[model samples]
Target: MTAQAVAATTRPRPARAWRAVLRLHQPALFLWGVFVTLVSAVLLWAYGPGGNAAGAAWRRKCTVDLCDWEDYSVDRYHFAFRFSEAAIDFMPILVAAWAGAMLIGRELENGTAELAWTQSVGPVRWLATKLTVPAALLTAGTTLLVGLHRLVFDTQQVPKGWNWSDNGTFEANGPVAIAFPLLALALGALSGLIARRALPGLIGGILANATATTLIGLAGPHLVPWKISVGDLKQGYEAPSGAIYGGEGAVTSTGAHIPDPCSGGEKACLAAHDIVGFYSEYHPSSQFWPLQLTETALILTVTALAVAAAFTLLRRRTA
Candidate 1:
């Protein structure tokens, strides 16, 4: 039991384990996280309190014209969801999934698990540490992002909405939503193990996670425990520009503006009484916490399942 040997034996291998975890960082996932973070920051700055010079000028002009400066100003509540949509909503999940897929997928693909596990910590410990780093990073990153978004976007008049809550392209993939990302990472890690190629594993992770999100987003409303509806919240949920004539019920961005329709005055004259108000249809205030927690639970549950499966695969690989 020499001092040098004892010190070597006692040193924990967690750092190395994390290295193994991060070694799988794929270009796509890293880029996704970086791009989303940068974009969100820009959007937040643009829409934040007195965001841009033009916005300040508009507010100043509106204040001079209107009696109540506050009334004319586009406050947080007025553009809550829109700002959140641009700022901090759906990117975290993508980062999470990319990390998850890279976590075990890349190792499994290149058959580097054996080398990683040969360290003092066995395969299970190795995998656990690797998973921990990204999970921890994403959690910290997402928490900060969500908090920033709330500070900037959360408003009483307006509400905090999510890509999960909406049915638009902004709909979060697995890692995007807390619960969904857990499931997505699980699928991706598993996919990596089975597919064992970077591209295939990434695709597999995306497809499986996307399918799960779609199912949950679309069908979760109908199910129990996962129910996320805003009954009376729909009161103002009408399309921005009231209703469209001759083109289904589709409402475009312009319709939401509080002005007379420029549609040749045909529809304007017909529904002369119809005026677009600067109102938010999706009231996220009431359901913000509920939806966030629900989505978080889903991500955790899926993460648990994915971790279990990943360990099993690792065990089998090392066995």
Candidate 2:
């Protein structure tokens, strides 16, 4: 009942909990290390020699209004760049699947979780440790990869082969890349808790994350207000550089918008629709950070909710 003894008893053993989690999941941790290492190596190569060779080839090919179609120096860099992008893009799926099948699912299925709960760990701390460790690992690995990917990408290319708004490129270039895997981790942990079986947890986690991913992709363009570019009848419409195009249409003098009235140079056809101008709607380059941050916020919000739900479910079950 002494104050010193009471304080000692009350102090949290986070290190103990973390050590247990890491020891139990050492295989997964090793695999993740390998994954990050391999990805970093390829990306570093692409960021340096690969990028320089491609840039030089591109420069050589574009000068004097003439081009060398056989210049193959760009191929190696493109392969590395594309592979790295694809890996990061699919990272959420991989993380979710592994978390569901291995992290919580296997433990629950074999009664290991109950064993831990009985050993004074408790369900809430257990689940928190499960989520926290992986989230930290994921964040670090993704931040490094995203930084390297941004370096490997050539933002200065004329005509921009891989635009910032491109699907894989967009995800790999910002904090959303980091947020997505965390979201996936939450989704998988929740799914594992709900299913309490390895196989079903694996399937449910991947499907749940897939659904969220698709929804996010569909909502990305709408996250930021569309900027419109309009041109008079005497001129044509084209979006500004670095803009992510949404749609286009013809504009009437009365401010009504409609589809293009003609494409065969038929002036009378245009007049029939009362079209007096054309317009393009897009997210301009300035909106890039806004869009990226908005998506990251949305994803992290869901991630927090999922983690909360997992804890709630665990507490209810244990109580």
Give the winner by lDDT.
2
Q: Please, what are the lDDT tens digits per residue for candidate 1 over residues 5-62?
A: 9998895645565564555555554764785486457445645543444355454555
TM-score of each model, in listed order: 0.59, 0.88
Point to the candidate with the largest TM-score: 2
Give lDDT tens digits, candidate 2, residues 65-176: 5555887667777778779889999889989998888999989999999988988788888898888988999999999999888876754333235678877988899999
- C-alpha lDDT values of all predictions: 0.50, 0.86
Error of 1 at 276 (Å): 31
lDDT of 1 at 251: 30
Q: Model 1 scores what on Cα lDDT?
A: 0.50
What residue pairs clash in candidate 2, if any at all? Answer: none
